[model samples]
Target: MQKEVLIHVRGLQMMDAQGDQEPIEIIVPGQYYFRNGSHYLRYEELLDETAEPTINYIKVSGTGLEVSKKGLVNVHMVFEQGKKNMTYYTTPYGTLQMGISATNLELTESEENLQIKADYALDMNEEHVADCYLAIQVQPRDCKDFVL
Candidate 1:
């Protein structure tokens, strides 16, 4: 089963001598959960090495619900885009410790109408680790739009 997610993005521009690039700060309310029989608990999901990843990122996008709608969805995350082998996050858990390095985040149109799929990978350092991937997909609503 799949669900919709509400993601909040703040506009930000990073400037350097080369040029100025504006990226949005994404605030996503996580909603993915795992059940351990008696109780349904918040759980973390990771990506196996089968998916190839070049750069590290923190990505979030749509489910099987949004397809072929440009600007209707967003696959947002943070990482050094140009640099190769640059790690986006590494064990930066302040109170709780875990690094979910998302990469290859892609959202594309499928053959089916209004149905989209998002794919990405999580860089997990250990075989058995804490579940830190907090992802929540939600219903769509009208939000204020901003431009760079």
Candidate 2:
């Protein structure tokens, strides 16, 4: 796929069991860049032969670009499952963080000549996060590869 089509997502999830709330799942869509500043991302549905509870879609649009993503999101598949972790990314309620198992990430935009690299960890912290890291690079798709 091209480098200008991506919708990144990261946040916490809550589940209700026995009339109580608990942290049973997480959504870590990795980090991305558009270079154009802001963009849009939207998703309606998706399919994954493996993961049963596959993610429907992920959309993002800001000031520069737009994109849609679909697939299964397993924190355990991407994270190391930390110790009773509780994280947040939206609203004015609580903090947001997640357990990640990303070994290494490298994204290089051959067009824009940009790149980024990141590491993985069992635990992370996001006391006050908003998760507004969606950028866009519209049309003609002109950019380079980037590393996570």
Candidate 3:
């Protein structure tokens, strides 16, 4: 991938406990960059109506994904296929234990773009929260001034 790129992130969250699944879809655009062996997508989170915007980074790899947020609500979580991870989710109010288990993970890449799709289940403080799906696509941006 190029040094400067465009990132599209789509997330679906199931809201109901019954068989009827109401998914909430969120789409966000951001800047993408790569360093070493990891790909990073930088974006600002403004959905929570917080005072300050939270800087978020979605780190992608061949085996898993790690998402980190800094600002109003801080959290560092990891997701790997067939593996469970436990981490602490920090917020203005307090901190809570977060658990994430991945059901499926797929990654595809080329010289100019990459795509990641993951399905996972989330648990907060040992209680099942939601089953979620995250899709991220990164494509190289054409910029005259930016050098890759």
Candidate 4:
């Protein structure tokens, strides 16, 4: 892949108590690079007209993946197969203790694209909130297979 890329992200949150929720999907332009044996993807997300855009960073390593966001909300989350990670999530509304217990983590990469899928359970304030699935696809901006 090239430095300029298109990222397609799909996220599903299935509430343990309430059942399924709508999946969130987004396709955006992003920057991709490799450093220190890790692949990094960076993008900006505009939450609304008034607030500044949020910066998102994803780091993919051999062992796991880490996602960090800064702006209106700040968070640093880690995902590793069979491991539970905890962090404080700060948002405009308030802060909460968040936990991510990843059940599965898969990655597929080729000359043209990179794909990641993660299945995990999410917890907030020590209570089970939901089971989540996240899929991320990254490809060169000029790739012919790119789609919305």
Candidate 5:
């Protein structure tokens, strides 16, 4: 069964070369479900101020995780600790060769809530772009005490 959920995402990107940091935070309505052993969170990219909202699917499992989205930014990314995955990022302007190497993946789940933290290195066009950290917190729609 699928349950309605509220998702809060906070991301930080630090450029390895320039040491510039970019931070983004957003809270969106989403759905949470489980299939087999994998947990799935489906949401839309509404706060990006885009003409069309991108549908995002985040699948988490024991081995790794996959994030796929279509619309404003189209990309399918895989993060498995200690392994690098190559992919292409598509935008309205053009496509760029993207690589992601996951350094850490931590997940916690309980009856109360679910939390995930991931750290990785990001590269674009074979050049190091940034070191990234992503944290996601999911809770039932009724839960209001959790803060970003």
Candidate 6:
């Protein structure tokens, strides 16, 4: 992918015991780069009109994926297949302990695009909350074939 890109992120969270919820989707312009055998993506996410946008940084490598967010919210999350990672998630309302246990992680890359799909379980405050799926697709900004 090029340095200037468009990113489409689709996420689904299903209550472990309750059921599935509607999926959330977002498309935004972003910056992408490759360094030291890792891919990096930077983007700003607007939580709402009244709130400041959150800046997100994602790092992807062979072993795992890391996401760090700043601004309106702050968090650093790690995902590695078959491993449970814990971290603190801070938001305007308050902070909570968060955990991610990834069951599957797939990464596909090409000269013009990149795709990532992950399936995991989520825990909040040390209790199992949900099972989640995340898919991220990135293409060069100038690519005419790119679509949400």
TM-score for each of the candidates: 0.20, 0.24, 0.80, 0.96, 0.94, 0.96
lDDT of 6 at 23: 91
- Tens-place lDDT digits, model 2, residues 1-148: 3434433233222222333322222222233334344222232223335444343322222211112223343222221112232333221244335543434443344443333223333334733222112122222223243223
Model 3 stretches with alpha carbons more than 4 Å out: 19-29, 48-50, 142-148
CA lDDT, every prediction?
0.26, 0.30, 0.78, 0.92, 0.89, 0.92
Q: Candidate 5: count the clashes.
A: 0
**Against the hidden true structure, what lDDT does model 4 obtain?**
0.92
Which structure is stronger by lDDT: 1 or 2? 2
lDDT of 4 by residue, 39-145 (tens): 89999998778999999999999989999999999999999999999999999999999999999998888887899889999999999899999999999988888
| Clash counts for the predictions, in order | 6, 41, 0, 0, 0, 0
Question: On residues 122-147, what C-alpha lDDT tens digit does candidate 1 reach at each position?
Answer: 23343223211222223223323311
The residue-by-residue lDDT of candidate 5 on 39-104, one tens digit each, is: 899999963674689999999999988999898889999999999999999988899999999999
Task: Encode model 6's per-residue lDDT on 1-148: one tens digit a residue.
Answer: 6799999999999986668686999889999999999999999999878988899998999998888999888999999999999999998899999999999999999898899889999999999999999999999988889754
C-alpha lDDT (0 to 100) for residue 21 of candidate 5: 95
Q: Which consecutive 10 residues in model 1 have the weakest lDDT in total?
A: 63-72
Task: Provide C-alpha RMSD values for all models, in order.
Answer: 16.2, 12.7, 4.5, 1.3, 1.6, 1.2
lDDT of 3 by residue, 1-148 (tens): 6666666667776644763454544444577777888788887777477478888888888768999999888888899999999999888789999899999988888887778888999888998878888887777666333221
